[model samples]
Target: MIPIAKPYLTAEDAQAAYDTILTGWITQGPRVQEFEEKFAAYTGAKYAVAVSNCTTALHLSMIVAGIGEGDEVICPSMSYIATANSIKYVGATPVFAEVNQEYNLDPTDVEKRINSNTKAILLVHQIGMPADIDAIKKICSRYNLKLIEDAACAVGSAYKGQKIGSHSELVCFSFHPRKIISTGDGGMITTSRKDYYDRLRLLRQHGMSINDRVRHNSKKVIFEDHIEVGYNYRMTDIQASVGIKQLEKLDWIVTERRKIANKYHEALKNIEGIRLPLERERYFSNYQSYSIYLEKSFPINRNRFMQELLDNEIATRRGIMNSHRETAYKHLEDKVNLPVSEKLQDRSVLLPLYVPMIEEDVKFIIDTILKLTQLKTV
Candidate 1:
């Protein structure tokens, strides 16, 4: 069956992992540092800290941003649960906000939700589509609020002329298999601030006063101290080895994904009651997931459509979920009224999209979707 998303990995990536493992430095050491430096250079960030996963990256970002108990972080509910969970990890309340047509946080709605308790705006570049950064930054500037970016699916995406991670102060990214790049499962946080960089490095490795690499390379024996309480969130050298290779092929992978997305746009744009994803002017997306919004006038409901695709050997998934509607966040169900977020979650469908997909499979999937979505008329 055609999968919803897949990483563009190669034999070289495997070889990198194998080579790194053979070196006996299998933990967070030189390889992790190299990956961090390369990633920071790629995204134009002054520094980057590798972590176990995006959730840990977000947790660290929240901590460095000074979000804590009684503080409210404004974020879109239409995102992975981890987005909201990170705020809670640092003892901050997540104030769910609405999203615009681009599926990113709506700055206008964000402003309306702001109160004296609001501390920061956690903006997500949903599905690699860059949000209105300038617009959101303006709002943050006006209110003296901090802006942290959830760029899990936006590693290669650009907002205006700069990359997604480079545009924000504290941007977190994922290297999950479902993303354009893969390190089995890992994450990174990019920041320009030296203080944030130093603290993040310390926090990811149990708040040690000196990192492992520093001590290992030193000629004299040195003792370390736990400066503060921190989590074991460091990314392994095994993952970093793979990540370094994956990062090298990221631009090519994004190009291939965009090609597949363009084919989908061309084939499905004529269909009524189907709203395709959009890339606004100067906003470059990696097209991590190609989701189509099904309007009420659509020929079939989202569930049935996905089932049909599954039957046809083409896997599909529901759109980005609303964390507020989940059992874990049931308390927020009655407190928020996000019509757009709810509608998009229920009606949108994610089509199969991956790099290096065969032409025959791509055509077959497109043909099946077109046939299934044929407009009905008198």
Candidate 2:
């Protein structure tokens, strides 16, 4: 069956990994530092810290931002659990906020949820499409709230000509196999604040005053003390080797994904009872996952449509989970009604999308969807 997502790796990545292994500096070393520097340059951020995964990156961001017990982090209900899990990791409450049709946090709803307990707004660029960050940033600025961008799906995405990671005080990225870029399993945090950058660097490596890489290169064999409690979330040099190669091809990979998205948009635009993904003006999406919403009038329910696609050798996925409904967060009082988020959860489905997928594959998926829609009308 066709997979919902796939990672594109070439010999370049393999060679880089081999070189790192031969050097015997596999743990967080020169390669990791190089990856961080390259990633920061690509996103135009002053600093980037590589970690084990996006979850850890988010957790580090929270710790650096001083979000802790009793502090409420406003986040969209419709997002991957990692976004909410990070808040819990820091002993903070994640307050649910409504989403717009774009499946992004509604700035208006976010503003209403802001209270004295609220410390930050954690916004996800869902499915590679950018959130209404300009408006969200305004809300954060007005209330002096810290803005954390869970940009796991938006590696090459941009808003108003600025990269996604550049806008927020702290932005988290993922390089999972299914993501636009892959380093096996890794994450990075980008920020302009020097203190936050330093804090993240320290927090990712067990709060060590000096990292092992620095000590290894030093003539002295003396070790350092732990400054604060931190986790062992450092990314290995081997993984960073792969990441450096992936970074080189990021733009080309994003271009291919966009081409596939455009093909879907062109083919599905005329189909009735289907809402295609939207590309807001001045925004550029990586199209990491091509998601479409089945309209209420569509004769076939989302589950049935997904099943049919799967039966026809096409794979699909439900949209990101509603964090408020998860067992972890159910106990918290959900004061806000996220109608849009709930509706999206029911109707949204992700289509097969990745680099190297031929044009014919896109057409085939579109045709299958259109045929299914037509059959339901009979």
Candidate 3:
């Protein structure tokens, strides 16, 4: 069966891994530093901190931003649970907010959620489609709130002529195999602020004044100190080696995926009771995930539709998630109604858009969906 998502790895990627292993410095050493530099240069970020994964990246973003206990961070519930969990990692409350037609955090709803205790807005570029960054940035500036971007699936995505990482103050990215880029399981935090860049660098490596690589490279014996309590969230040279290669292919991957996305749009646009993902003007999505929304008027239910796709040998997945409905965030749930977010979680399906899918694969998936939607076609 066709997969909903898969990593686009080449023999070169495997070779990079092997080369790093041969170097005998597989920890967060030269390769990790090199990957950080390349990623920062690519994203226009002044510095990029490589980490274990996106969740840890988010956690670090929160810590460096001064989000802590008694503070509330506004984020859309229609996202990966990691988005909300990151806020909690800093002992900050995550207040659920609604999303717009673009499936991004709605600025209007976010404004209403902002109380005296609100510290930041964790905006997500959900599934590689950028959120309304301008509107949200305006809100942050007006209220003096921190703006952190959960850019997990948006490695190669852009917004308003700028890349997603360069647009936000603190942007967290994922390199999970399921994401646009694969580092096996790695993440990066991009920021233009020198202060944040320094703090994150110190915090990610156990808050040590001197890093292991620096100590080992010293001609004479050197001492180190733990400046503050920090987590072991460093990315390995092995993962960074693979990430470097993945980064090289990012632009081409995005171009090819956009072509596939266009095909899906063309094939599915005419179907009744369906809502398609939108690319806002100047917001270039990488289509990290191609999710389809079955309107209430659609003939089939979401589960049954997915089942039918599986029966037809096409694998599909549900939309991101609704954190409020999950047991993990039960205490965070509130009376505030997130209608758009709820509807999106319940009605959306993620179709296979992995690299290497042929035109025939795209057509087959489209034809099946059209049939499921009860549209007439040959």
Candidate 4:
């Protein structure tokens, strides 16, 4: 069966891991620091803190951004629960906003949701396509809201020539296998703010003023005191070793994904009752997942279409896991009308997309989709 996503790893990654094991410094050591520096340089961010996963990164960002009890963080409803979960982790409330037809946060809707209790705007670049960053940034600036970018699927994506990590004050990236790059399971937080960078460094390692690596090299064994409560969210050196190698090939992997996306666009553009993913002229997406919207006129419901694909040995998924519908978040204020987001929740499907997929696989998927369309017409 063709899988929805797969990690691309080479001998370089294996060799790096071997080296880390041989060195016996596998817990948040030199390799982790190296990975953070390289990632920051790649995204043009002043600092990058490697963590256990994107969820922890988002949680750290909330703490550093000063979000706390009763504070509302405005975020899109059509995103992974991690975006809202992080806000809750900080004892803050998540105010869900609507999304546009493109499955991104609607800036206008976000503005209407902002209240005196609002502290931040958490924006996710769903499926690697950038959200309307420029408009979102403008709105955040107007309201003096802290902007945190949940760019888990947008590692190499850009908006208006600036990288996604550079656009927001705090940006989170995932290195999960499903993402453009992988370190098995890891995440990083990029920021231009020096204070945030320093605070995050402390936060990731149990709020200790000094990290273990620093103490290891010192003549005196120094035990540190925790300045504030923090979690053990540091990425292991083994993971960082793989990440460093993956970072070297990030651009190539994104290029391959984009090639597959282009093929899908050309083949599926004319098919009625199908809405192809759109990339604005000013943006360059990593194409983490190639999502297509099934129009209301489509004869088959999204669930049936997904089941058909599964039967054909092809794997597909619904768009970003909707936060509001999830059992954990159902208690939050549900009065907001997120028409576009809700429609996408019911109709959108993510086709198989990854760096290793070739043109042949792309053709097969597109042909299968077209055949389904033809059958519906009959």
Q: Find the candidate with the highest TM-score and give its number.
A: 1
Alpha-carbon local distance difference test for all models: 0.93, 0.91, 0.91, 0.90
- Tens-digit per-residue lDDT, 213-313, candidate 4: 98999998788889998889999999999999999999999989998888888888988789988888998899999999988788788888898888888
What is the lDDT for 300 in model 3?
83
Q: Candidate 1, 360: how far from true, in Å?
A: 0.8
Off by over 4 Å in 3: 332-334, 375-378
Taking the tens digit of each residue's C-alpha lDDT, what string does model 1 give over 1-378? 888877788899999999999999999999999999999999999999999999999999999999999999999999999999999999999999999888999888999998999999999999999999888899989999999999999999998899878887899999989998999999999999999999999999999998888999999999999999999999999999999999899999999999999999999998988999999889999999999999888888888888889999899989899999999999999999999999999999988999889999999998998887773532
Q: What C-alpha lDDT does candidate 4 achieve relative to the native structure?
A: 0.90
| Model 4 regions lying over 4 Å from their true place | none
Residue 227 of model 2: what lDDT?
97
Candidate 3, residues 232-333, lDDT tens digits: the string is 999999999999999999999999999999999988887887788999789899999998898878888888889989999999999778998899977656
Which structure is stronger by lDDT: 2 or 4?
2
**TM-score for model 4?**
0.97
Give TM-scores for every candidate, taking all chains together and pairing residue i with residue i: 0.98, 0.97, 0.97, 0.97
Lowest lDDT sum, 10 consecutive residues, model 3, at 369-378
